[model samples]
Target: MQDSAAGAATMKALRRRRGLSLAGTARALTNVAAELRLPALPAVASVQRSVARWEAARPTRPDDRYQLLLGHLYARTPAGSIAIGPGSDFAELLTALHLLGEGERRTAELRTAVLRAATDQGAGMLSLLSPALQAQLAAALADPARTTDETVAGLAAAVADVNGQVGTLPMVRLQLLLAPAVDAARRLLAAPVPSAPLQESLREAAVAAYTVAARLAFETRDDEASRAAYTAATREAAQLGRPWRQAGVHMSHALTTMYATHDLAAARVLADRAVRAAQRGESILVRARAHALQAEMLARAGQARQVDTALRLAWYDMEANHAGDPAVTSFSAGHLRGFEGVCELHVGDPATAHDRFAHSAAALAAPRELVQRAIVTVDQALARIRMGAPQDAVELLHQSVDAAAATGGRVPALRLRDARQALRPWRQETWVMDLDDHLLDGLGA
Candidate 1:
């Protein structure tokens, strides 16, 4: 009973970290009861009150069975037939895993059963489980061979089931649940990582989480949070022990420095770190991304030859490695391409800049990403304006602003501000004046 009570307390803590409401927790419990074919009416109410009491300034008896259920619920995997009454030992095991970041030996035994259940009736698990479990399952399914299209389909079905059962949860919990997806994605890109269709789905989930957190940070101008999340994501990528992923983290950090803050020297240092890490891994894709970012930062510092050298490396690395289209970058490679093109123009190569911007914009077109799309769009518009296409530039800038507004992103808005400042002298020659006025009116910068 004491062990279960302790587990119950941990469960409550996880819920609090996730920021779930009592009603939301109750709904999740109700869904769990229904899935288990247990009595829902009073049991769910009991769980709800117990959870509330745990949250309050009082003490409640820790129910072992309840804590076990909560672990299974948060785990998103099948609890199997483990005896889970008030004195069960599973609660202690789970508590240890949560606090120590290491699951017990029994956790591995449960893995097979969990995988079987995730493969078979994963839909039920999804329906009865919380966001945290769903995220873990997404990570587990990231192997390509094991997680084929069928596997991804199963996982998606499970996610949908859980979505239907629990509806929307607190944003923070949802974010935490998605963290594993990001971890899984790094695995997919790593050298020893497995290739699974479920990996693609997991990648999509990770991207979703990044987009949300990045957008929130950009909107609130929370540079600290933005730096922290991006850095943490990079750390996760590096932990996967893949050169490309490590480089990708470096590139991401570089971009965060470039656009999120005004630290060019720090940005260059990060870019250097990315280049070195990618080189160490012998990952052509990673090297190319790092070089390209380096070029952008160098251009900012008025180093023309360095820009040329960086782009040269980018092109050469992609060609040598037979890498796939330079897909990954610090700030969405496709959009950063436009900014790179603008760098060429700054160094007195309008034609080259024009071509680069066009290619970059085409690559970035209609992405599902709100934040990436907006950043790329803003760069694209600026590139066009520099290339003497004022009308197209104006329209593109407007679209960029709209996209940024949708995500509530002040960083992109600030980028737009920089573009406007550059075109200040020609404000009357195009629609730049009106758009600039609008931006200043709302953004106050």
Candidate 2:
């Protein structure tokens, strides 16, 4: 008789034959577990290593829980029929009978029940809003009210506030603040307003609102919402005939493609389009920001020489323009340096990245933008890890985590996860374990 290792090999072969990468398989398992209401799902890296061990003919076999999940995900027969060449693991045989008997059917019913419950809860919440609030919302959606000069001025101040809050407020909080404003602005744009000057102001305000809305969505990982907001912003900017506003929107869209979607080719095209649009605009600030965005994207693509050239152009443009519109451009010397550091990190220069992050950290410390501060701290931590200083990396990561907790930002949480993954090799170390435990507790993971 053949060994049980043959069964493990078959499972590995099946996964490969289905054209699923290790990450894809892990995601499938996770989704199935969630649907089945499993108590816990395995990590992606854990699943990857388990697959490798299985293929290597290790003693370990897929556990009962994993067996059920994999079977459902791959549409395989019940566990009882799963053959391992000859003899099965005692644990596998013991659980197989129970799993095949009634567990499978019960799990399917539980998944359906969970879906129905979720749908019902969502409907109930929507129906819970006050009647007056619902009527006002309906009116805003159906027919927009006309805008006045005072309203436009108020909107401009709100845009400025939104701009200032970018690296300070949590993304969810920002989204909550911007959503109603964006809706109101959209309605005002649709309503008939007699004053041409007021109409222009309203359009500008709408563009600003839409741009902020897009940024909020992007930061929160809502790609479709971000894209829709960007589209709306671009349309408003075009109607306002403001090349600078259009350029700003294009730059933001480029960032969304680059960071959010990870489409390098599409990001490059949008970045170039932003530069061209900025060049056509009268505002030097627009040109400066466009160049800065181009530099950041080029750095991510590992185009080192082009990155320096783009950064240089950005600096030149900023120097040529003394004044910048706060609502239009957030470009500054310190912010540019932060981007330069990010570029250096991507270009594989950890030392330079560390130095640049240090500078940015110091510069931002005075104003104390919690989100930006956390980002720079995490970047520094990553650089330190790359430079083979795990201890130093741990310290910086702690700072970043604290900053993130203070700001209630998801970006910091994501960076912390990356740091944790990078430190996996040192998992057995007491300090590393403590740090991991701390992170899990704090992040509510």
Q: What are the TM-scores, per candidate, against the unseen true structure?
A: 0.51, 0.64
Model 2 agreement with the true structure over 1-445: per-residue lDDT tens digits: 2355655556555667667777877887888788768876768888767656645645455565765666455432133222121122222332332323325334333222322332333322112122333344455446445344655655565555555555544566556656666877787777876578878988988888898888788878788998999999988898876787788889888877776766988989988988998887877877887898899889878898999999899989878745545334456666677787888888858998899989888777533266777887888888898899988889888777767765566667777888889898888988788787778767764
- Residue 94 of model 2, lDDT score: 23
Give the lowest summed-lDDT range of ten residues in model 2: 82-91
Instruction: Supply every candidate's count of residue pairs whose N, Cα or C atoms clash at under 3 angstroms.
Output: 4, 0
lDDT of 1 by residue, 252-344 (tens): 667767776688999899898888887776566667777877788888889998888888888777566343533333334564466577577
Scanning candidate 1 in windows of ten residues, the lowest lDDT window is 162-171
User: Global lDDT of each model?
Assistant: 0.56, 0.68
lDDT of 1 at 64: 44
lDDT of 1: 0.56
Q: Clashing residue pairs, candidate 1?
A: 5-62, 143-196, 144-195, 144-196
The best candidate in terms of TM-score? 2
